[model samples]
Target: MRFGPETWSYASLERVSGQLAGALRSRGVQNGHRIGLFMTNCPAWLAWFFAISRVGGVAVPMNPAYTGTEISSILEVSDLRVLICEDRLASRLDSPPKQPPSVDVLMTSRTLQVNGPAEMIEHAASPDPTAPAVIFFSSGSTGMPKGIVHSGRNLVRIVQTVSMTWPLRSADGLFVAMPLAFVYSSIVECLTAIRVGATVELQERFDPDATVARLAAGKITSMMGVPSMYRMLLATREQPGESGKLRFCATAGETLEPALSHQFGERFSCPLLDFYGLTEAPHIIAHSNPAEILERPLSCGRVLTGVEARVVDDHGQSLPSGETGELVVRAPWMFDGYFRDPTATKAVLKEGWFWTGDLARQDAEEYVYIVERKKELIKRSGFNVFPAEVERVIREVPGIAEVAVVGVADTFLGERVKAWIVPRPGVAVNVEQVLAACRAKLASYKVPDAVEELQELPKGPTGKIARKELRH
Candidate 1:
């Protein structure tokens, strides 16, 4: 694994992971115990994840950017036994109402130390394939996010499916800029590269200039990022670097506009393929073939071999090809369920299919084209920004009578969070004040980029706010 200015050979990573596992065992970590990983994208993050999995502990990856309130909710729901967090992120847990699980703050400067033995410790085999292995939080439309659990078998199956579909060669170098906490980055950029024995170039965060320089230096062969990252790269006015070696760039987490895709291809002289999936199924559901992008620019391409996708109506009846409807999918491997939330899990997972809250259409050739989101979830810069979650935070601000959050189109970010507020009578609400309050409570991406003050927001006959009308 190669992170800017530092490279860890496979052997070195294995040794560190083993030592970390030994340390975890000595600290009394047991099989099935949840271990929270709250850190940025770094070598230590990966090492701790492997160590936890090696000791049969379920890994719960927490977004390092989450605020104290957000992190507290996850800790309460997950009931983690141990938390391995970077020193910088540990401050977020300083004032939890209830004391959180035992935390082991880690620094990059120190190597993992083992007291008794540094020898490799084999993991106990899980008797059931469905046993929980990892927990991921999905933005909730109602309010708080739900924890999606995946099994050990699900991880192996997703890696295998991705390796077969993309088929990266050992000589290739993969560049990853997306957050590792996101399932897309973890599966496509990390595990897939490891499976193919390809070198991974990790970036702690996306920087357009640094990314372009690496590509120009011919240090990376393939790159994976979200639509926003690609837009940033296209926005740069600098001369295109030595990009001839870049084979292709894959994008997901939000819709990839055909115009943006065209502009990126024209600028970089490489195919900008669209990838589509969700946290429920971490593996790519559909991906555009690099060679066929010109012919099928709008499509997300064919579904993977082991995956079944269909456009269905509200009744779960399959819609014919070329018709827009909800996209339902059944894959060989998928998330087990929403942790401790059988009600929510049952709502989406029916029989053998998972009903994705995405409106899409399918061509006769089985290529999927996303239309719009059926849910009220806002995706800004590849991160989920739940309107309700933001509203809950913003509603507490003084002089705020009511607030409604929606996603507005953006050239660079695909969609940015926008809030419409109706202030209380005789009180003045400033946009900057509302934003300042949100910045303290919500993640950076969830903060509203624009705020509008209205005497009264548009409402439907039922007296509920009409989000669709506000969107227009």
Candidate 2:
């Protein structure tokens, strides 16, 4: 289960990480020290992760898609002692903090170029399951990021649960284009492959043609991505090559549109399974297989073997199966609460149940369907409007590739519905035309006050819509 750049095999990665661990030990990156990884999808990112784990230090993976200011905030909050970044992106960072003396900043190019003192890169073999493995940020608070801390055993539980649910094996080669910063893809696609002894194909970033080429070139058996990634992949011109290698395709990080899933699965001749998970309660909560989609298309699938899921109202009372409420999850592998933020942690983690702010409902058979985000609910003219419900109807209209519904400040109404859309390829979307379509499907009050077409919506590293950023 060795991995890194194609040229530097698994053995080389082990040697480099072992050498880097020794280097960090020499430079005073001791056990329990937090090390920040500020780089995009690359071998070095994974290299630093394993290296930190070797020395029992916590690896903090920052979104490489972040600007300098955003990255600086995480560095300060996590109290990072050592920062590892790609040399090319060094200029993105601003001046050093005035208070701290000076933190050690190392580059990947420097690490690979220099001759190391040790050569056990293939596998250093430090199996301390209790050590803190990594920390990721979840967008729970309005603008602030909540750090999610996960232990090695916690991560192992996640990986084991997903692999068992999907039933991936050694012969399966996984292709992951999502940012390593996100927990879902990082854990399921990257670490799970390593833990299960599967070959992983690494890409620096996702490109439609490049992604298609890799899927065709490599023995790619499975892929895990967000819904948007699948949309972009569908736009690529089909190549006459082997497609049977692609056995399973899973989508997460956001709700998957039924329209998109049907279209994508038909094109690839592979079933696109829909999965549901969150950063707080990180496990495969529900899955929609091809057969399940036929009977219950909207169901996110029945609960997993060990996971306890339910819907509860504001008063913490469990709702009936057919009623929609805040989706709460209680799993053995759930996260250990937010880091250094007890008040925020206590708010969500109550009575062994994680109050996932996501709105959902369960069927009589225990199937779940996410409706919308509780925070994303909007009030316009004293009427409640759930963005996902509006967007779901709008997406049903032909020629609409993507749509995001937001409540914009209005003079007349307290807040009016504003829809941002990305049109399908080669089709010109008219505002009046879309409004007419919405008028047919939705009530007058639910219709968008304005429809603005964009080339693409702003997406965070994990591929979720950066709704907060869109406020400006």
Candidate 3:
């Protein structure tokens, strides 16, 4: 893994992880204890992760960008025995008026480097295959943060499934700039590459110019990002010929519309593949075929191997092909359950299936198309309006960088469609143009009743557009 000026081979990572594991055991870390990794994307993050796993500790990765209140709330819910963070962020753990509850030990990058014994080795049995080993927080969550737990074996299975679906070999090099606190970056991209001995270039946070330079110089052969990341990268100016040696680029954590895919492919001369997944099941659960998506727009590809997916009604009865309903899936690598929330767990994990709360449908050929979140379905004038459908149409409008459609209360219409749009930097957006595009492709009721523009939309930890905040 390469991060800034530092590079680490697998051997170096194993040694650092071993040393950290010994230090953790010396500090009383034990089997089943929950530990929080509150840092950005770095080699230290992975080393600490493997170290925690080596000593049989459950690793809880927290978004370093969260506010003090948000961080405090996660701490309360995480049951973390130890919390590790960068020295710069460790001070914030004591943020005034709401200092986070103290864990058994709070280790920072500086402290860990200074205190770790250089020659110590880790000696512990592997964690239970069924026991929770990692807890990844879900996006679009309400109230306190919701962490989805998975066993070590489950993580292995998820990596294997994605690696097979999105083939990568040892010779491949990945450019990873997405947030590592989420599974898409940490497991789907990062761990998946490691599973095949592929090298990676890690970025603490995304910088479009830096990323463009890396791609232009052929520093990496593969890239993975969310739609927003790709949008920003595409917005940056680039020369025509100096493109990355990318065989393919994968995107997830949000809907992948055709307009963006075509623009991205044209800009970088690489095939952009879209995958669908949840925090509960890592990614590449379903992936897109370039030709199939063109033949059937918005298709999220077919269900992957070792996985069963069905679109079902509220009663859990499976709907026929071309029928829209809640998307429920069954997979061997699915998450164990939500951490310490059986009541919430039971609500979604019905019998043996996981209700994905996503409104979607399947074609006769088994191509899956996600419409929107079931909860985000906008009810307008007694007609069901899926926000994603409207948003998809709005995105086709020129100059629109991102858009979020929400349902605002209306005494007469029950809920009126309200669209929040963020235009490309330095570009002027015509609300009339947005409405016209929507009118052309969408039903009258599905078009935005009220339009508002913004510099940017609120995003969840996973980089998916957060409609919950806009609704509030």
The candidate that achieves the highest lDDT relative to the unseen native structure? 1
Tens digits of per-residue lDDT for model 1, 151-249? 888988988887777747788889987778887778657888988899988888898888888878878888878888888987776554655677867
Indicate whether candidate 2 or candidate 3 has the larger lDDT: 3
Best by TM-score: 1
Candidate 1, poorest ten consecutive residues by summed lDDT: 107-116
Positional deviation of residue 162's Cα in model 2 after best superposition, in angstroms: 1.4
Identify the superior model by lDDT, candidate 1 or candidate 3.
1
| Candidate 2 runs further than 4 Å off | 1-8, 95-102, 110-115, 119-131, 377-472
The full ranking of all candidates by lDDT, starting with the best, is 1, 3, 2
User: Tens digit of lDDT per residue, candidate 2, span 294-389?
Assistant: 677766777788888889999989999899999888887888878788998899899998888889999888888888767885555434466776
- Measured against the true structure, the TM-scores of the candidates, in listed sequence, are 0.95, 0.77, 0.79
Better of 1 and 2 by TM-score: 1
Candidate 3 clashes between residue pairs 3 or more apart in a chain or in different chains: none
Give all candidates' CA lDDT scores: 0.81, 0.73, 0.78
Q: Residue 279 CA error for candidate 2 (Å)?
A: 1.8
